[model samples]
Target: MSIKINTYITILMLSSAAFISPLITKGQSTSLDSSQPETVVQKKYGLDPSKPLAKRIGNTPPEIIQKFRDAGMSPTLHRLSKTDSLKVVRAFQMLPPLHQHILKEHLLGISFLDNMPNTALTATVNPEDQFPVFTITFRAEILKQDVSQWLTEKEMSYFTKDFPGFRIAIEAGKLDAILYVLLHEATHVVDGSLGILAMDQNKGTSGMAVNLKSFTRNIWVDRTSICPSYTDSLTSQSRFRGGGRLLPMELARQIYQSAAKGPFVSLYATSSWHEDLAEYLTVTHFTKRLKQPFRIIIHEGRKEIFIYEPMKSATVSSRISLMKYFYAKAGSSVLYERHVKPGGRGFNG
Candidate 1:
């Protein structure tokens, strides 16, 4: 079976502003009336500043707008919500203000449905006339379960030797599975936006196709786009598990060994360059820069067989440099702090 690389990568990846001026009303009061029983009339508006920008203003689709509204979030906003509205609102508020703004400006909407079909977090773009509308969806319950299962002694040890505080953060609620998924997916959006991993619209169709652009220091150019190389690599991999496949013991060891020798960040990253970039950003941001320990330990009847630590790979650090290119183009001050390392460019250099 053949899968369109751009659309397939999008499906499998696992992972705005305003101004105003007001005119004076004929009988507007400058001061509040204390004694005359002032009647406060509330006015209703179509768009919200705190929510995702409206399609008219930001090019988000009407259907997505309605979906968020039905979920009690925002109409044209990059809003977030779950089945229960209040919890999602509070969770959204818990994020840093700059983080929230970056998301709201770039994203169209976020929905926490309990019945998402794929990974805990996945992204899809609804192409628009002006700018593509990106929507990120999450299944909170399934996502938590996926993260727990992925970090098992058996699975973790085979992937890397760099122990991360990911499990600890999950337990403490400081680093949630949903949040991790969101960040990974968000990196994809940032990548596409920066033209680092450029996406081209399929001719005469509404679908998107991956356009692998060359990565220089400052700009992304489409000279020798390696579209086939990425797609071929992804398809050549075994699909024992749906997304990227977790292999059997011997094969898995060989795969991880090969990955360690490669420029990819994680096992899943080997699937495609897009994924390679996403995992690179996600793992580095959480593990090295954040000073978190993402360690893995495995035992066989009483003996420990293997352990994985992702941050120790030189190849992984090299992939992280690509993010410096991304951050520089995004020009977001928050992004710098999010990915920037102390003495070097990004994520422990």
Candidate 2:
């Protein structure tokens, strides 16, 4: 991802138009990390911003395959089959208008990678550029599973090993995995667009002050670290926060107890403020608007040891009211499924 070339394209096409004639709801999707430098991920995978969303669905880029090697994982590019492609497109269509609007405006393209353990989006960020454009890369297998199966697999990555009688499960029912992932990634888009997390902003440059966003105010000290009041040494040692080894299953109960007391929704949310925003929005929407369950079952041998449902926490509820910032511009109710459009337009984020 050459910041030079893409900056030219984005500045001329996207930034110029968006700023000159701003869209009703605006922003970019995904976090920053240019996957391949040979050519932009959008062009290599046949992504044309001029095309409609459905037409944009196609093969994964080779750069995505190479990116897995950085993590020592060998993943192949998996083009979407006709049936899978429809499911992917449908998932995008189901999203709220704010989400739809953000992706439609700045998404260069989206693709899949086989053998990839998780879903991710990469961006080429130039602080001078207001709207940082991005492309999404998903793990191809997600197309086959519902939200529960997908989330359970993802949530289990926190632990060292998964053995019988000592396991964790996410009983989130049958919401489509693609829908959940897209919504989750889209929140990152909102973060990038609204400067919600400030990770890609010019704050890191010397003499530049870090002013935390309203969403991150008391929770995060900076993009990578949380406030001391919210930080606990135990959860800090969990896999996601630079802890080398995974945690033991025996500590699941203690983990949930500490997490429930914090502003965080999940252990993974503790990874950073960027992911914190993503996980927060994803869980709230999944359980509230979608009317689904998000339960974490930690089992010890044959017995259920601890169950932590984020939706019920007082700390979690505090964040829900703040989510209105995502859609409040249109004066729509916070976290509601029926996204009202600007003035009187139809729901189309």
| Estimated TM-score for each candidate | 0.54, 0.73
Cα lDDT listed for each candidate: 0.38, 0.59
Candidate 2 lDDT over residue span 277-304, tens digit each: 6788888877777788989988777788
Backbone clashes, each candidate: 20, 6
What TM-score does structure 1 among the candidates reach?
0.54
* Lowest-sum lDDT 10-residue window in model 2: 12-21
Error of 2 at 170 (Å): 1.1
| TM-score for candidate 2, residues paired by index | 0.73
Candidate 1 error regions (>4 Å): 1-8, 11-49, 52-102, 121-125, 142-174, 199-236, 240-246, 296-298, 325-349
In model 1, state the lDDT of residue 155. 40
Question: Root-mean-square deviation of each candidate, in angstroms?
Answer: 14.7, 10.9
